[model samples]
Target: MQKGSLENHLFRKGQEPLGWELRLKIAIGAARGLAFLHTSEKVIYRDFKASNILLDPVYNAKLSDFGLAKVGPINGNSHVTTRVIGTYGYAAPEYVATVP
Candidate 1:
């Protein structure tokens, strides 16, 4: 963990569309991290996206800020379970819809 900032990533600051390689790398890292949290640990990520993912010196990703986590699932874990509470844009689409 090199403790780099997530805000520096191309997505966080919205520094325009990224070159395919950098963009793909970020997506891959995020998905890989999410897969681990979702299945490897049997934990569903109530919140996901660029803002919550920090980077190390080498740009390796580290999932950070898990305040909204739940034992089962965050509000949007279901299609009709409205109970939204997450950052704008970065939150998963399903989760965002839960806003009430």
Candidate 2:
């Protein structure tokens, strides 16, 4: 079944705002999905934000929009250099700084 992004639920007008319990659960679920990506596959989700998280009818959260996801650094390198691209203010501050 088709589902909408978390942003849709949060920003839709005339609808009751999501309760704190659901919000907390969504946050925890999103974090778990992200943690799996990082620990299981070493993926860096560069575009992690509300818009990229979709919720099912029961409000189960899942990460989407993998276009910006990157394989993390290998061989013990400190970091990987790449073009800065992500929703403004959503990406971490250090990620937005252009590296020479």
Candidate 3:
């Protein structure tokens, strides 16, 4: 529980920056986690951001804070309609247009 968000590690002074390989690994892990949510779990992560990604001591990444997540549209539907809720500048253009 003491592990901090990726943002902390990235921006904190006096901390060594994440190496290229470790950064790549974290990116891949985050992608795989998001992919699993979108495909296997039918969930859309509306709040993907550095602050929402938690890292362990070894730098393994895991997504956290699903308060803004929503269930994906049912099969055969092009998109689901819902009021948009997430950090500003992070929402997709389509999502911004779709939200009232």
After superposition, which runs of candidate 2 have C-alpha atoms over 4 Å from their true positions? 1-3, 75-79, 92-100
Candidate 1: stretches off by over 4 Å: 1-3, 11-19, 73-81, 89-100
Which of the numbered candidates is closest to the native, going by highest TM-score?
A: 2
Q: Which ten residues in a row have the lowest lDDT in candidate 1?
A: 72-81
Worst 10 residues of 2 by lDDT: 77-86
- Count clashing residue pairs in model 3: 0
lDDT of 2 at 72: 78
Score residue 79 of candidate 3 by CA lDDT.
53
Model 3 lDDT per residue over 1-100, tens place: 3568888879989988888999999899899999999999999988999999998878889999999888887878755655678887877888778766
TM-scores, all candidates, are 0.64, 0.81, 0.80
Arranged by lDDT with the best first, the candidates are 3, 2, 1
CA-RMSD of model 2: 2.5
lDDT, candidate 1, 1-100, per-residue tens: 5745455545445545546776677678888998888776756577675667777776667788788765554465653345776678766797677666
Clash pairs for candidate 3: none
